[model samples]
Target: MVGVAVLAAALLLRYAALEAGVFPLDCAGAAADGIGGLCAAKWLLVQSFLHQRLGWLSFVLGLAAFATRRRGLAWAGWGSGIAGLVLYSFDPAAIGALLSLLVLARAASQRRRGEEQPGEEPRDGLGVGGLG
Candidate 1:
């Protein structure tokens, strides 16, 4: 449930950021430079790659992770999400997406381990004391 919501948010943010060109222009620089801002060009060339390309990639992965329950898929999603988040700090959508993927991965791992040793009981805090 939460994962789905996070994934959705990430997708939305990525689309909005791309469509708005939110990364190219530094707000402070733009304000100082006015309409024909050199800062915009500088920022665009420097930041557009990650904001436009990698951002979309991350969003796609997040969406896929939300739709699927596989551990490997979740890890991929999380990795992309983290990369996107690190690159784009203005939006926290990627962070949420990453969290969802992490949760899914943990659940999947636990489930797999449980299945591998179905008959065995889980170990408690106490150490083994029996001597052969």
Candidate 2:
């Protein structure tokens, strides 16, 4: 999923930009100090990844999945939640991941039971043009 890939990139970037210091963290002074090659942009992203921003984002995705019952939302919420825990945003991320799992499980069960999506017509030769 795109969310998973984004988090993975963030993890790698954190390793490079923050842990390895491949680029200076103090990029607000980039222009003044003549730093080049997107250092300021990298710094801005790294800052957002700190301070539980990802945790809140995962939680919101979980809430959206619960409200909409969409597998895409659930997958994003779950993956981002696990990534958030690793990225230093634990509690909310854990809860959000659990929520996403529950939604996925329910969806899987509905699929097994031949349930139709809300507002969707059944195509088993019972409606519309009699799809046999």
Candidate 3:
């Protein structure tokens, strides 16, 4: 949810800072001048999230969500992946998006460890994890 909100804000920032004739695809010059905060936001949205070569942020968030089984992290990974793809960071973003889906599915289907009754028999009754 927070990720989505951040993305929305980024979209507005993109229009206002970059698309609004404020920077004209040139960030460095604008930074040298006085007006930088919005331009910095522009640089961050473009260089950091959307146009980054590797989509590292999305990749890392996806990997973390995959490893930790946290739905919130999964949401973040998914959002970043979308940003990466829709705005130019394609391949790695695909990986990140896939990882996010897997994490969400795993979180939904898997039972919590704390809920298990230590030696309780598998409810499916195939003799442990339904593997039999």
Candidate with top TM-score is 2
- Deviation from native of the Cα of residue 57 in model 1, angstroms: 1.5
Estimate, for each residue in 24-117, the C-alpha lDDT of model 1 and write its tens digit: 5445644555634545554553463444554565556656666665555566556555545544632543643575466586676777756544
Per-residue accuracy of model 3 over 51-97 as CA lDDT, tens digit each: 46436677888899999978998888888877676556778887887
Model 2 misplacement above 4 A: 1-10, 30-36, 116-132
What tens digits encode model 2's per-residue C-alpha lDDT throughout 2-98?
Answer: 5568677767866765677677555566356765667766655656567788888889899899889889999989888877776778988878888
lDDT of 2 at 16: 66
Error of 1 at 131 (Å): 49
Name the candidate that leads on lDDT. 2
Candidate 1 residue-wise lDDT at 110 = 71
- Report how far residue 124 has shifted in candidate 1, in Å: 22
TM-score for every candidate vs. truth?
0.38, 0.63, 0.59
As for TM-score, the candidate ahead, 1 or 2, is 2
Question: Over all chains combined, what TM-score does candidate 1 have?
Answer: 0.38
